[model samples]
Target chain A: MSVLLSPERVEIQLGERSYPILIGNGLLGEPRHFDAAPAAASALIVSNTTVAPLYARALRDTLAGRFQAVHMLELPDGEAHKDWQTLNLIFDALLRHGCDRKTVLFALGGGVVGDMVGFAAASYMRGVPFVQVPTTLLAQVDSSVGGKTAINHPLGKNMIGAFYQPRLVMCDLATLSTLPARELSAGLAEIIKYGPIYDMAFFDWIEANIDALMARDPAALAHAVRRSCEIKAAVVGQDERETGLRAILNFGHTFGHAIESGLGYGEWLHGEAVGCGMVLAARLSQRLGGVDEAFVQRLSALVERAGLPVVAPALGLERYLELMRIDKKSEAGEIRFVVIDQPGSAAMRSAPDTMVREVLAQGCAS
Target chain B: MSVLLSPERVEIQLGERSYPILIGNGLLGEPRHFDAAPAAASALIVSNTTVAPLYARALRDTLAGRFQAVHMLELPDGEAHKDWQTLNLIFDALLRHGCDRKTVLFALGGGVVGDMVGFAAASYMRGVPFVQVPTTLLAQVDSSVGGKTAINHPLGKNMIGAFYQPRLVMCDLATLSTLPARELSAGLAEIIKYGPIYDMAFFDWIEANIDALMARDPAALAHAVRRSCEIKAAVVGQDERETGLRAILNFGHTFGHAIESGLGYGEWLHGEAVGCGMVLAARLSQRLGGVDEAFVQRLSALVERAGLPVVAPALGLERYLELMRIDKKSEAGEIRFVVIDQPGSAAMRSAPDTMVREVLAQGCAS
Candidate 1:
C-alpha cells in the first residue's frame, strides 16, 4: 500500500546558484516536476546502461513537452567507469548532437551517473546547466544533493572534480523500489552520517526508524531523505567550497576512502566503506577524548544493523596510512579526519600515526 | 635598451576572486612577484618542455624561498598535447608527490601550459591556489589575465574547462625576448583584438606602435601588455562568466574556432586562426551593414602587418558551416558570430547562410 503525499522540497541556499531537492512518489514521468529547468531547445538525459533500460523513456517523454528536442545517452554502469573516459562519452554525445551551452543535461541513475553528468555539465563549454534525477538511495540523499561533482583518479577518489551545483534535483521515491538491498544499506550509511556530525536527534531518529527505512516505507524514507538533505543543504549553503564547515560532511570519508583505494575503488561500495569508516572514526574519536566508548559501540551497532560492513579489509596499516595521507583533507602529508568531537558535533583534526594504526589494527579484519 | 620601471599592476576587480596582473621586465625570477600567493608547504611549477629548459629553474628557485618544497613538471610542447591525457599528467604528479589541497600550483608557460595547469588546479581536490606566470606574449596579453582555462577536445578547442581565476598573473616582459618571431606576432593578434572590440583609442595606439611591438621594444611591449590587460580586466570584471559582455572578447573566436577545428588543432596557431578569423568576421560585419569596407580593410591590413595569415584555410563552405555550428556559442544548431557592430563595438548575432557563404567564398584561399 502506497502512502500518497505531496512532494517535499528542501532548498539549498547557494545565493545565485541555489536549487531545490524534490522528493516524492511517481515524480518521474510527470512534466510538472521539471518546470523549474531552464528554457532550452534541447535536453540530454545522461543515465547508466542499467538505469536507462528501466526509466529513460519516461524521462525523455516528460521532457519532450518542454524542450524542442530531447536526447538520451547511456554510459556504462558503476564506479569503475567514473573516469575521464566515461565522462568523455557525455561530451562526445553532446558534441555529436551539437548540444549548446543552453542545452540542459539531466543526470539519471545513481551517484556515478550524477557525478559524471554533473562534471560533464561543469566542464562542457566551460559550464552548462544540468539537473540531477537521482535513482538510487545513495544519490538521492547524498551525492545528488551536493554540488561536489568528480571522477576518481587511480590514486584517489574524487581527486578530479568541480564545486558545481545542479539547477534542480529530483528524487523519485518510486525509484528506490528497484534498488538492490545492499545499496539500500549503503545509502543508510550516508543517512547515518549526518546524525553523528551535525544532528544527534536525526541520528536517534535513524536508529529508531532503521527497520522501517529498510522496508522501503515511503513515510520513513521521505523523512530520512528530507532530513539528510536539510542538514546537508544548511551546511553546504554556509560553506559551498568546503573551506572549513563543509569538511565535516566527509565524516567517514578519510578512512572510507582508504578502504576503497586500498582495495581499489568498486571493490566495496562508497557507502559501505563509509559505514565501516564511521565505526572506526568513532573509535578513534573516543581515543582522542572526543567521545566515550559507549557512543562508539552504539554507533557500530547501528552500522551493522543497517547491514553495512563493520570490518575494514585487511590492507596493511602502512597502506591505510599511505592512502589516507593523500586524502583531499590532508595537509602537508598529514591526514586530517572528520571525527566526532561531541555527540552531535564534528571537527577536522589530525591524530598521531600511533593512534591511527591502533584503530586500523582493531578495525580491519586480520 | 632595458626600460626599468616599477611593476605595473592591473587589478581584475572580481570580488573575492579578484587578483592583480603584474607586468614588467624580469618579474618571473623575483620572489616579490609571488608574495600574494597563498602560503603553502609545497608548490608545483607546471610548464612545457620548450619553456622548462629556459625558465623552470629560475621559477623553482624563486619559489624555494616561499614554499618548503618546490617541484617542476614539464609536459610535451604544443597545442596538439592540450587534452585530458596531458591534464592528467598534472594530477598524476600532484598525487605522486602527496601534494595536499593547500599546495600551490604555478602555471609557468604559455597558454597551453597555463590552460592545462589552471584547469588542473581548478579540478584537483576541487581546487587549489595557482599563479599564472605567462611566458608568451599571447598568454601575457590575453589567456593568462582572464581565468578562461581549458583543454581542447578532439571535436572543439577548449570544449572542456572552468572559469577559475588565478591568485596572481605575472607577465615578465623580459621573457618575451626569447619568444620566436612567429609567436610574437601571434601575441600581437590578441593585442590588435582589444582595440576593435572595446577601445578604438587603444586600436589607434596599437596601429602607431605595431612596429615597435613586433620589434619587442621594452616600453612599447610593457604598455601593450598593461593596456591589453586593463581592457581585459575591465571587460572580465563586469562579465566573469561570458554571460553577455565577456562574449565580446571572443569577437574573432567563433570563426577562429572553426578555422582551428576545420584544419585540426595545432595545424595553425590559435592566434593565427583568430587573426584571419577577425578579417573574415569584419567582412561579415560589412555585409550586415554594421561597418563599412574601409574598416574591414584597415583590420585586414593590420592583421597582415602583424605577420599572421590574413587568408583563411580553404576548408570549404559546408565544412566551415558544420564546424561553426558546433561552436559553444551556437544555439539549437544555429551559428552565432561575434561581429563588429560599429568601429569599436561588437555583438553576437547570426547572419544569413548566403552571406556567410559569400564571405567564406572570398576569404578562403583559392
Candidate 2:
C-alpha cells in the first residue's frame, strides 16, 4: 500500500486555486482523497456504475471514519450518459442527501464519470470542489490531469464543458486493472500525443517501451502515467484555458472528437478515435510541410506497435471532411488540426480538402 | 464617423491577456471590438434570434470587412433556450462558416445570449476569444462586466458553464432602448447587488437615483454600469473563481438561483426573482445579526422603487426549503445566503429552517 502511493506531489498550478494531485494506490482508502477533505457541513461522493463496485466501499470506508455524515450518488456508466440528465443525478443526490455548499464530490470512474462529476461540481453552486479518482488509463494519463471538465452535447462530444481546474486529481494507476484492453490502448493515444506534440525524447521512450507499456507493465505504466501528468500539468500551468499553447495538446483531438461525435457517443473509444486521428494529423502535417514523412512514420510505428488503431474507417474523404468541420477544433468552416511542425513542436493548422482527402485516404488505408 | 464609430475603452486590469470593454453608440457598425482583437484568421459572431435581427448584420458587416472572412450564427433567444441545443447553433455556425483556430466570437445580447455565446466560445476549438456586447442594464453592469459565462441546464439554472473570461466586453447603452421593462428591471437587480455587496456609496447613489435608473436616464445608467463593472472587476481580479472572497458576490444569487430552478425557468424573470431574493437574503442577514433591520428597509425601498417584485410568492415554506435545497449553492441540506454584514460588505451564512422559514414568510408576504 505504501509503495502504491507516490511521494511526488502532482501540482495543478491554477493561481490561488492550485492544488496537489496525489497519484497513487490505496490512497482512495487513505485520508487524502476523501476523508482529509476539509470538514464541510456535508459531503457527497458522485460515482458511476462501473467504478463503484471496485472503489466506492473503500472510499466510503476511508471517508466514513472521518465524518459523521456522508452520502453516495451512483450514476449510469458510459459516454452516453454524459449529458445534462446525468448531471442532474448529482443535484438529485445532493437534494436527497441534503448536502450543501461545502459538499465535496468524489468522481470515481474514467473520463466520462470524472467529466460529469467535475462538471456537476463546477456548476453545482456556481462551483464546488471535486476530487478526481480517475479509474481509467486515459483519464489517469490525460483527462483527469488538466482540469478540463465537461459533458458532451448532442451535436458534439465534450462540446459543453468548462476549463475548471480540479481541487485534486488522484490517479490510482491500479484502477487500470479493471479497464478493457481497447481502453488501455485508447489512453495510449494521448500518451503518444505527448511525445509528438511536446517531447520528442518522450516519444522515443514510448517507442522503445511500446511492448511493456501496452502490456500494462507496472514499471512502464507508472513511468508513462507520471510523465504524462507532468507534461499535462506543465502545459495546463502555462495555459490553463487551452488558449494558444494548450491547444497543441489537442494534436489529434480535433479529428478525434469529430470521429467520436460522428460515429456517435460510445461508438468509438475516445483514444481509438484519437489514435486514428493522430495518423491523419501526422499525414496532414507532412502534407503541409510542417512535419516530414519520417516523423510521421515514426509516430505511426509507435501507434501500431501499441495495438492502437492506425487506420481510420473508410468514411469517404468528403464525410471525413464533413465530420472534422463539426469538430471543436474548427472555428468557421476551416478544419484545423493540431499538427506537428517538427518533433517536440506542434501547431494548429487548417488542412484544405484535397490534401486533407489525401491524408484521410492514407489514414483509412489498411 | 470614425470617432463616433469608435468603442469607448474600459480597461479591466488583469494582465497581458486582459482586453478593454468597448462602450459606445454604434460599434456594431464598425470594426472597433475586432480591430484590437488578437489578429485571428477569421471571426464568428454568436448572436441570438432577437439580437441577430437587429444587430448581427451590422456586426457581420464590420467583421467581414475587417477580417479575411466573417460568419454569423443566430441562436434562439430566452433563458429556456440556453442549453446544449442553443450552444450547438454556435457550433453549426462555426463549422458551416469554416472558422478555424484563429476565429473570435462576438456575443450580442443580454445575459442569456452572453452566457451561451461565451460558453460556446470557451469550448469551441478547445478555447477561443470572445467579446461581449451586453444590451440590457443587468448585463451591462453585471454579466457583461465579469467574464462569468455559462449556459443553463434544465435541472438547474446555469448548471453547465465555465468561468471563461472574455477578451473584451462591449456595452452599447443605446441597445437598452429596445429592452422590455421586465428585462430592464431584471438587469437592475444585478446593478443593485453591487451596492450591497461591495459598494455602499454606490448603494446610496442607487437609492437616490432609482427613479432615473428606471426611467433609463443615460447618465445614471452609464454611471451604474461603470461602477458595477469596476466593483466586479476588482472582485473577479482577486478571485476569478467563487472560492473565497468572490462568493460574497453571490449575496442573493444562491437564493435567487433556487427560486429560478424551483419556479421553473421562464416562469420568473431572473432579475425579478433575484430582486425578491435579495429581500429574503437581507432579512436572513438581519436574523443572523450580520446587519440591522435598517439595512433591510433601506434595500427594500430601492427594490420597490425599481418596480421589481419586492415580495416572494407563497412557495410554501416546505416548497421554498425544497427549492433552495436544489440550488447550486446548497450542498448537504443547508441553504446558504450571501448576507450583508454591513453596506458594501457581504458574507455567506447557512441558516436553520426556523430562521429560513421565518424569512420565507416575510419574503412571500404580499
Candidate 3:
C-alpha cells in the first residue's frame, strides 16, 4: 500500500524564511529527506514519551550522518504538559548539551510537539533552525505546515508564542500506522476543515474517501495529506501573520478554544474540539444568512462521520462567552469568530449575543 | 537644565519593523511623543516597583487620551527578577485584563523592564505592538534601542528570547535626574561603549564630558543618548538579527555576560559589568595586537572616572572560561569575543585560552 504513492513536496514561500513540507512513506528513515537542513555540529530531536519510543531513534539515526552529534529529548505526552515548565525542559537540555546558535532542532510527533519545538527553536538563542517530523495525521495536515509555534497558558490556549518558521516539515505518512483510532479521526477534523473554508472539490473528495481514510488506506491518506498541505501552504504564504486572511483558517477555532479552555486543556484532543466547533460555526453562518440550512447540516454530518463530537459540552452560555472573549483573535472584548460566508468561503466576523446564544443553545447538549 | 535641550528623534531603519527613538526632557508626560503607537482599545504599562511610583502615572495619563483604557502592572526591581517568573507576570496581567493582540504595551523602566515587556509583547498572542519607555541611562542608550528581548535562564543570560522590535522607544532625560549615582555611572558604561566599537568621536565626547554627565546635565545627557542611539540604530538597521555585523555591538558583552553569570545576576548591574568587561577586552585586544597598551590604559582610566570598576571580579580563570563558553555569542563551545581592532573599530574574533588567562590574571583582583 505504501508503494502505491510517491513522495510529494509543498513549498511555503516566506522569502528567506521559506522551506518545504515533504510528505511520503518511510521519509523519516531516509537521510536524503533532510538534505536541506542547515549544516551544524549538532542536532536535537525533541519529541514526547509516546512518540520518542516509536520514531525518535529513526530520526536521530538519519540525522547522525549529517551532524557530528545527534541527541534526543522526550517530553511528557499530551497538551497538559505544554507549558513554560515543559518548554524549559528543551532549553535545559540544549544548554546542558552546550548546543549553540547553529544547532538544529527536529520536532517529532503531533501538534503539541511541533508547536513546542518550533517555539523552542524560535526562542533558543533567539532563533535556531528546526525540522518538523510530524507523526500524527493532524500535524501532518495542519499544524506542522504552518510556522505558528506556542505553548498554552492557563488563562488561554497558545497565549505565548512566536511567528517563527521552520527549516523543513517532514510528514512521513508511515508513522500514522501507529496513531490511535480516536486520534486519526481528530486529524480528519482539520482535513475536513479545509473543504468548508476554501475548496468544495477537496470537501467532495474527503466525503467520498472518508471510509478509505478511516481504514488507513495509504493512497487515500497521501492525497488527503498532500491536498491539505497544499491548501495550508497557499493560505499561510499569503497571510503568515494572521493579520487578515489567516484568521479564516481558524474557522472553528473560537468555539473550539472555548471548549478546550472550559473543559481544561487535554480533556479533548484539539482536533476533536475543532471538529465540533466547525459545526457550531457553520450553524452561525446560517443564522447570519451567509450559508443555507443544507450547508450547515452537511458540515455537521461530515464532522460526525469523522468520529468527532457534533454536540458541545454544556459549559453554560456565559462561561463560553467568557472563554471566547479572551481568545487571541478577540479585540476590545468582542469575540471574533471565523464564520462561513458560504460553502468553501470564510470570513472573520462578530455575531450578536442573541444570535450566538441561539447557536450555542442548539449546539450544546441540554 | 530641563529646558536646555529640545526633543530629538533617531530613526532605527529595519524596513517595516523600523521605529524611532525619542529623546528629550519630560517626554513621558507629553502625549504627543506617543503619536506613532498603534491605535488600540487598551494599553498596558509594564514597569517595576521602583520606577512605577516615579513615572507610570505620567505615562498612563499620556496614553489615556489615545487608548480607551490604560492599566499598569509592577514587578519587583533589579536583574535578579529578570526570569520566567517575572516574565509570566506580564502575561498574567495581559490575559487577566482581557488584553488582545491589538492591545499596546509600554515598557516603563530600565533594561530589565524593557527586555521583559518586549518579550511579553513578542510572545503574547504571537506578537503585539510595544513601545519602549526606558528610564535608566543604560536602557535609554542600549537595550531599549535594539529589539533583543529575553529573560535570563538558570543556565545562561538571555538564552531564551526573540528579536522582536518595538513600535517606538521613548527616552525621557528627566527620568535620569532621579537615577541613583551608581546606576547613572552604569549607564555611562554603555554610553562610553559606542566610542571604541563604532565612533571614536563619541568616545572623545564622553571622555571630555564625563563630569557633566555625572552631574546630570540635561544637554550633555541628551547628546550622549542621541549619539549612542544613532550609532546603535545604524548598526541595528544594517544587521537587526546579529547574523554578522550586528555582533560587533557586543564589543564587551562576552566578558560582561560571564561576569554577570559567574556572580549571579543582579550582583552587578549589566552596564557596570560591561564597564569592567571593556577593560578586560581592551587588554585582550592589546595582546592580540588589535589595540596598543596605551589605548587600553586610556579606556580603563575613563571607566574608573565614570565610577565603574575597571578591575574584573576575582571569579578565577576556569570559572570565567566555563561561564563564557555558555555566552550567547559563543558558537559550538568556542568563545567568541568582540575585540577592538583599533581605538575606533571592533571585530568578533576567537583568542587562545593562554591569552585570555593572562588578561584575566592582570584584570581580576588577586
Candidate 4:
C-alpha cells in the first residue's frame, strides 16, 4: 500500500477556513498531502538556509505537478533573523517573481520560517493563503497548529504579527529524524507543557514517553504531536484572539519571553527559555497556593531529564521584572502569568512583586 | 446647542466588532462623543506634526475624563514618512510608556496618521483597540470608514497592512476648514469616486454641488461625507477583506496605485493620483465599450472642476503596465482594472495591451 492511503489527519475546524494537519512517515513525497490547499497558478516555498538543502527540493518536486511555477526563497536561519528586514526578503522574492495575490506560500522549515511566511502571506495584498509544513518538533506540536503569525520586535517577542490561520499544517514525522539533539529537547519542552496546562493525562503520557521521545521513536512522537495539536486547536477555536481562555496556552510564555527578550532573541533556544519558564511559573503557582511545591519539583525534573533548562539565566530579578512588565498579558504594567491550578488546569493572575522576585532569585539553576 | 447632541452617526456593522462614525461640526471637544470606546486606563493619541499642534490638546483633554493617562506621539507629516521606520516610532512610544494590550490608540490625523496608527494598534501585542479620529476629508470619507490599514513598501502602495477594525471613527467636519486648497481638492477626488462606482444619484448630486463642496460649505460637505460613508459601509460590510465586492471600492486605485508607486510615494497626494487615474479608467471603460466616450468627457470635466487632475502623468506606457501588474487586484500576472459599466457600476477586467497603450499615449498631459 502507498504511504498516502492511511496518513493520520487532524482537523482544525475554523468555519469555512478549516484545514487538516496531515501526519505520517514520508508524507512529503505524497501529492495527496496538499489536498486541503486550493490549487493556485503559482507557489512560493519559503525555507531557511539550513532546512532548504534537506527538504525543499523534494517538496518543490511534489508541488511541481499542481503549480504552473514553483519558487523557493532560502532565508538565513535562526530566531534572531525573524524580524522585518528578513520578512521583507519574502515580499521582495514574491514581487520580483511577479507572484500575485492568489499565490500560495509553503513554509518549509521551523517556527521562524513558518511565522514569517505566514505573516508575509497575511500582509501581502492584504491577505493570501499559506500552508505550514513545519519541520521542527516545537512547531509540529505547537506553533504550526494555531493561526498566530508574527515577527519579534527589538523590545519584545512576537511583538509584530497577526492572527492569520494557515490553509493547512503538514507535519511529517520523518523530518524530525534530522533535527539536532538540542533542538529536539526544545520541542519536548512545549510537548511537556500541554499535560500540566490542559491535560494531566497527556502530561503523564509525556513523562512515561520522555525517553522514547528523546530516542526519536516514531510512534511516541506522533502521539505527542497529535495530542498537543488537539489541545491547541480546542483552545484557539474558542478564543481565536486570546481575549480569554486562549491566554492559558501561553503557560510558561510570560517568563519565557522575559528570558528570551532579556538575553536577546536566539541566545537561548525558544524551547529552552520556555522550559525554564515553566519551572518559574509552577513555583509561582505553588506560592499562590494554586499548586503544591511538589508539583513544581516534578515538572522541573522532567525538563532537566529532557535535557532542557530548568533554571533561567542570571538576569537580575529587577531586569526580569522590567522585561515581564511589558508582556501582552500585562494590564497597565502589571504582569499576569498563566499559573497551574492543578495538574491539568491553568488560569491567569497577577502575583506579588516580592513573590516573583523570590522565584527569580531562587529559581535559577535548580 | 452642543454639536455632539445632534451629530450624525453612521454604524458600520461587522458582527460583534461593529463601530460608529460620528460626523459633526466640532465633535472632538465633547467628552460624551467617545462613549463607544471601551474604558481604558491609558490612551495614546497618534497624530502627525502638522495635525498634532492643531488638535492634540483638545483630544487629549477630552480623553482625560475616561482615561487615567493620555499620551501623544507626533509623527512626521507626509506620505513619504509612511514606512516601517516611521511605524517603528509608534512602537517605541508604546513600549517606552509601558502601554498594555488594553491601552487604546486614538489615530488623530489624516489618512497617513490613521492608517499607520490603526496598523500599529492591530499589531501591537497581537491586537489592541483603536479609534479613527480622521481630520482630513480624504480620511473621513474613505480610509477611516473601512478597516483597511497599512504602510507603503518601496515597491508598492499599502503593501504591508491588515484589515483590523477600530472601536470608533470620529470625523469632525470643523477640522477640514484648516485643510490646504490642494488637499481639499484631493479629498474631492475620492468623494467623486463614490458616485461613479456605486451611486449615480450621488454623482449627480456632486456635479450639482461641486461649488458648494469647494467653498467648504458645512452642509454640502456633511451630505457628501455621509453618503460616501453609507456606500463604503455597505461595500465593506459585504466584503471586508477585498475577496470580492470590496475590489469595486478600488475603482480608480489600480491605476492610482501605479502612479503613486511609480512616482515614489508622497510625490502626489493620494487623491490627486486617484483623480487622474479615474479619467484614465473612464477612458479605458469607453474604449472597452463598457461606457460611452461622452460619459468619460463629462466625468473628466467634473474632475477638472473639482481642481483635480484630468490627464495622466507622462510615465511611459511600459512603466505604467509594469507598475499596474503588481497591484493587489492582479492575478497570475494579469492586470485587472476597475472599469465603469455605466455612470454608477464598476467591475474588474483586463483590457488588451495595445488598447491600454493607445489610451495612455492619448490620455497623458504631455
The digit string of per-residue lDDT tens for model 4 on A1-366 reads 123346788888788777888887888988888888878999999999999999999999999999999999999999999999999999889888888878999999999999899889988877889999999999998889888899988888888888889989999989998999999999999999998898988888888989998998888888888888888888888888889999998989999999999988989999999999999999999998888978988999999999998878988889899999988889988899999988899999999999999999898653
**What are the clashing pairs of model 3?**
none
lDDT value, residue B15 of candidate 2: 72
If you assessed candidate 4 against the hidden native complex, which CAPRI class would it receive?
A: high
Q: B330-359 in candidate 4: lDDT tens per residue? A: 888888999998779998889988988998
Interface RMSD of each: 0.6, 3.7, 0.7, 1.0
| Candidate closest to the true structure, highest DockQ | 1
Ranking by lDDT: 1, 3, 4, 2
Task: Please give the distance, in angstroms, between residue A187's alpha carbon in candidate 3 and its true position after superposition.
Answer: 0.4
The lDDT of each candidate is 0.92, 0.77, 0.92, 0.90
Superposed on all Cα atoms, the candidates' RMSDs to the truth, in angstroms, are 1.0, 4.3, 0.9, 1.7
DockQ of the candidate models in sequence: 0.91, 0.35, 0.89, 0.81
lDDT of 2 by residue, A1-366 (tens): 135545346777788768777666556666756433567656677778778888888887787766667688789988899987888788767656656567778888889888888777776645677778888889988888777787776666776666666777777767777888888888998899999889988988898898988788877887888888889889889988666788898888877776777678898898988887898788888888877888888888888877787877776667777877766666646677888888888888876688887777767854
TM-score of each: 0.99, 0.84, 0.99, 0.98
Error of 3 at A179 (Å): 0.3
- Tens-place lDDT per residue, model 3, A1-366, is 555345698899989999998888888888888887899999999999999999888888888899998988999999999999999999999999999999999999999999999999999999999998899999999888879999999899999999999898988888999999999999999999999999999999999999999999998999999999999989999999999998898989999999999999999999999999999999999999899998988889988888999999999999999899999888899889999887899999998988999999999999
